[model samples]
Target: MIELRDVHKAFGPKEVLRGIDLSIGKGRSMVIIGGSGTGKSVCLKCVLGLIEPDRGIITVDGQDVTRLRQGSSERDAFLARFGMLFQGGALFDSLPVWQNVAFRLLRGSLKRPWTEAREIAIEKLRRVGLSPDVADLYPAELSGGMQKRVSLARAIAAEPEIIFFDEPTTGLDPIMSGVINDLIREIVVEMGATAMTITHDMTSVRAIADEVAMLHRGKIRWTGPVTEMDASGDPYLTQFITGSPNGPIETLR
Candidate 1:
């Protein structure tokens, strides 16, 4: 459903992604794993048009989106098909939880009347294991795990065809992170949506990905099914999945 080829991006003297080539099939989950500054997030942003590539082609379902910036109509159309859960919960402290969950549905063309939006948001919240009573509370009032659940509810509220999870299990405790991972896996499989995730969490990768790609030095060092991840043979893949400090991936100062 998504294809990126020969992608390259740079910021002044720093070149983040160089010749990145990867693809995610329809209705499957593809997870990219890498250490910080290896260009995993940059590759995702290039696909999202949050950051444009200096050169390369990115296509969603066959349409080229390499250059569709924020204001372009095509970009808007492409975005309508996508839902993203950022690294942190990213909920608004000022808005009630329900409003945050329904932000898109209450403000965009997907907008329903206030009452209807709340109903939809609440339903999404339930799917993410949240109770109706949590809807009126503010983001600040929730625990980290609760906030992450709320963010998940928001991501799926519009029932998007493609979902991007950026460190979906980032800050929570291991148990809570596991819950989120399981939920993500269930939702993606049940919806049969194309899902792409970037995470350093090995557990999250094992739970959420059908295919795993390891990024190293601004390029994909290995790509294969999750079953093959442990046996990838490539030193880089072995190092990343095992979380070994001594490997081809250098520690950042």
Candidate 2:
């Protein structure tokens, strides 16, 4: 469903992605594990066409992502197939929860009457374990976990064919993190949508990924089925997954 071939990206003197070659199959879940500045998010942005790769190719659903001109109908159509849950909940504080969830549905190509959009928003909220009553509240009125769930609801509201989660379980209690993880897994399977997630949470990785790829020094260090991750015997991956301070990965402290 998605492929990156020898992808390279750099900002001025900083090289982020260096020949990243990876692919996620249709309806499969692939999680990227890496430390800060390792280019996990940059690779994702390249595929989304938010950042252009200086070298190599990125393709999604057989279309060359690099070739799609920004702001064109083709680019809009290309992006319409994806739903994203940003690192932060990113909800509009002024809008009620339901309106935030239905934000996409009320505008642009997916636009619908306010009444219909609200109904769909409510249904999606339910799918994410949120009650209809909570829909009338604003983001500031909700707890951290509830807000994240609302973000999840919004991501799936459009019924996208692909979903990208950027740190889906950040800034929550352990139980809430687990709840979000389980919900993400369930939704991906239920929707049969291809999933790409970048997170530092090992638990989320184990819960959400069918396959795991570890990026080190702007390149793929190790990648395999999640089942084989523990036994991959790669120092870079071990250092990452185990959170060990000592390994091929250099530490500041």
Candidate 3:
């Protein structure tokens, strides 16, 4: 459903993504794993059109996204098809939970009447294990896990065809992380949506990814089914999955 071909991005003299060729099939969850500064997020932002690449082609369902003009109706339409759960919860501090969930529904082409939007937001909140009473609460009132759930609710509110989850299990306890992982998997399966997630959490990757791709040195170094990952025997992959101090990957740098 998404493809990146020979993608490259640079900031001054430093090159981040160098020929990153990757693809995620329809209705599948692909999790990208990489160490800090490996350009995992950069690749994602490039595909999302939030950051334009210095060179390459990024396509969603065969449409070249890099060519889409910012602020154009076509660009807006392309973006409307996607949902994103950022690394941080990224909720508006001023908006209530329901309004935050319904933000997209209150404006733009997907806009709906206030009553309908609120109803949709409440339903989505319930889907993410939040009670209707929680809808009136603010992000500050919720626990870390609850805030993450609210973020999840907002991402799926519009029933998007594609969802990008950045570090979905970042700050929660183990049990809460497990809960979020399971919820993400269940939601993706039920919605039959294509998913792309970037996270260092291997447990989350195991629970959520149908396929796994490892980004290294500005490229996709290894990629395969999650089932095959254990036996792949790539030194870099082994080093990362095992969290080893010594291997092909230079952790000190």
Preferred candidate (lDDT higher): 2 or 3: 3
Question: For residues 3-32, what per-residue lDDT tens digits would candidate 3 score against the true structure?
Answer: 999999998999999999999999999999
The pairs that clash in candidate 3 are none
lDDT (Cα atoms) of all candidates against the true structure: 0.91, 0.94, 0.95
Q: What digit string (tens of lDDT, one per residue) describes model 1 on residues 1-253?
A: 8999999998898989989999899998999998888898889888888888999899999988976667777777789888888888889889999999999899766878999999999999999999999999999999989999999999899899999999999888999999999999999998888999999999999999999998888888899999998987999888877878898778766
In candidate 2, what are the lDDT values of residues 25-102, reduced to their tens digit?
999999999999899989888999988999998988789989999899999989889998988898999999999999
TM-score for all predictions? 0.96, 0.97, 0.98
Who wins the TM-score comparison? 3
Which residue pairs of candidate 2 clash?
none
lDDT of 2 at 176: 97
Which wins on TM-score, candidate 1 or candidate 2? 2
Give me candidate 2's TM-score against the actual structure. 0.97
Model 1 spans > 4 angstroms off = none
Predicted model with the maximum lDDT: 3
